[model samples]
Target: MTSVDQPPAFSDGAAVIELLNTSIGYGARAVVDDVSLRIDRGEVVALVGPNGSGKTTIVRGLLGLAPVVGGEVRLFGVPAGRFHERWRIGYVPQRHTVVGAVPSTVQEVVASGRLARRRWWKPPTAADRAVVSRAIDVVGLVDQSRASVSTLSGGQQRRVLIARALAADPEVLVMDEPTAGVDVASAEALTRTLARLVEDGRTLLIVTHDVAPLAPILTRVVAVAGGSVVGDEPARIALSPASALAGGIYAHPGHDPHHLAPDDPAGPAPGPGWLGDPGLRGAPAAS
Candidate 1:
């Protein structure tokens, strides 16, 4: 328990996760279209875009949760659909999954991540317990281990879900909206925990509308729009997380202008230039 486990084997120059010429969707609907992306080992890549932009669908394609209508997906050099090593990848789904009225405890929920490695009918081993305990400690939830998940706040429950993913001893973590709806304190806690994970050499692919809290540790940013990868580049620029969030890093810059008319019900809603106005870019005002 004192040392992190070694990363799984991968071929030279091979990406930890890859989607090549892929299209993913539900029945008769291709939500993510013709996307090609790669995440190398130990890289923290943020997938940012507007709602219905297929960011989550791309992740689902990687996890084999969505239908891959075309092309290929690979994890650690193995085809995603054929990859059997589930524990090598950890996933924290959107918050709604944990908000349900379930009677499970934090510890029990976290421990369930170990189920993939444990035998169907056998009980958890000493190693499983050690890892679960370590995971709880990693997320700063040792004191709340036994607390019922339903009793916890939305943010606390989110931390519990993170601990659950860590309990699997994964080399790559895929998360959707890690800080959405979370309070300031919980968001800070999550940021610190994620930084520690990156230091520990774990890779992360997070789909988020705001990367403000994660700016310090982020290595790259991948922008998805119209169900496609619009931007994929290094995030090593001078922009701080807060500034990036403010500077339209997550804004749907390509949104149609006609949709922002004054009388349109879908027009400029609120909160940080929801209307995608050009003035939001901090341009010089006309004389």
Candidate 2:
């Protein structure tokens, strides 16, 4: 992939990913509408919402998997549609298993992530091998590098997928449901892996339904519902255990603070200010 010769005037140098008043969906249907968001470098942002609430649609749109029907999406100061440096971003889709119909070793699977950086016909070089090994080590799977992916537990397999993404050494890592369906121990391990990535100054955009495990490390939390962002706040405020249990912030669409009855006695009914809204219901438009 080649780089853009000149960044468009609309590009924001401070933002790694910017979605300006964007709408996205399949074909003619728009699942997310007029949404604007900016993710800066070194930020760990979590997209939290119930299923079908457009969280995945936003991520897919950023990745160019879904069609953007309105506005623009930019990556690293270039229009996403024209951006050719795809290796700058690494993706880990929701996992069912690391091994497909054909089982591969953990090392082999992680090595595949480097395919984007190397020509298919060229054999792996020493540097490529070292990078792959480092990726595996980053995810804490070095000991299992030679094990068949199918033989590992669900959490270990998830790490392998992460290691594969890390192998590319992308500027940003976008993960969908990284903790989904894993045991507590596995979830903790995943969190530690992600924490390490954060310490390395890598930007991350994670889509998840459960945020408790990742709450401590998240810099920001964005709540999505009804095809729009409903809440955007610093993680300490949005994902706090108290706020979450009170249905105050980062609550699922079904439990939105606005849905609470005024006289029901679970604290006064929430208003626009509850979500840190500054007039508009969601976050202020990205500058």
Candidate 3:
């Protein structure tokens, strides 16, 4: 077990994610074991671990994306299967994956985030339009709202994704590797935005490798290994003042022991391109 300086502060009130007797696997093979964990409202919790540590699996289970072999998950206090609070949760995927290289305008794409709140087979209402506009403004994309997502710079595309998530005005924001691909400047900027979310009373859960750059701004950090939580602590006390914050690129003895950095001229830049990473196929732990 990893050492911790102090106990976690569990004061956000009401659980947003709960994994009870939760176990997940592929083809009857269990990768993550029975586990029970809860994330509270208004909390910013960071999930960290080595490769094949079950980070993505847990995320998928919480989102109801993958089947649960046993146990149950609850979102916003609702049973996982019956949970319909998607609009209350926002997700920022590692991939900028989208249809076509044709590129869609930032506003158009951000508007998609509100689809969950809309009724089935119905068009966007005036309220939806206002929400989208507010979301775009929050992410500082008002000027670039007309820009094409594909044509915009990498950081801009990321902002577009953030805007999409914010369009729902979600209560909790879940991000997987939110800072993996961008440059130092862009990544730092994104971190600032996340910090703002906490300041605004919105909860956030992020899976990350490093705690620096953004560490000084985080509320808590939870480490996972072998599919279970090894440590959960207050950011102010847990991480060493001198500890390295993982970012830019991680060529861990992890998911990709030899994973190349995005700047690898021969390698693909961060975004959808990483989806094709063969290293990840063998290293599900890193996700």
Task: Give the winner by lDDT.
Answer: 2
Q: What TM-score goes with each of the models? A: 0.79, 0.80, 0.78
Tens digits of per-residue lDDT for model 1, 135-174: 9888867777888888877777888888889999999999
Q: Model 3: residues >4 Å from true position, as ranges?
A: 1-10, 96-102, 241-287
Q: For residue 199, what is the lDDT in candidate 3? A: 80
Candidate 3: what lDDT? 0.67
Models, CA RMSD each? 11.6, 11.1, 9.4
Tens-digit lDDT string for candidate 2 (9-34):
32233678888889998888999998
lDDT of residue 64 for candidate 1: 82
Q: For candidate 2, what is the TM-score?
A: 0.80
TM-score of 3: 0.78
Q: Lowest summed lDDT over 10 consecutive residues: which window, candidate 3?
A: 278-287
What does candidate 3 score in Cα RMSD to the true structure? 9.4
The alpha-carbon lDDT assigned to residue 218 of candidate 2 equals 79
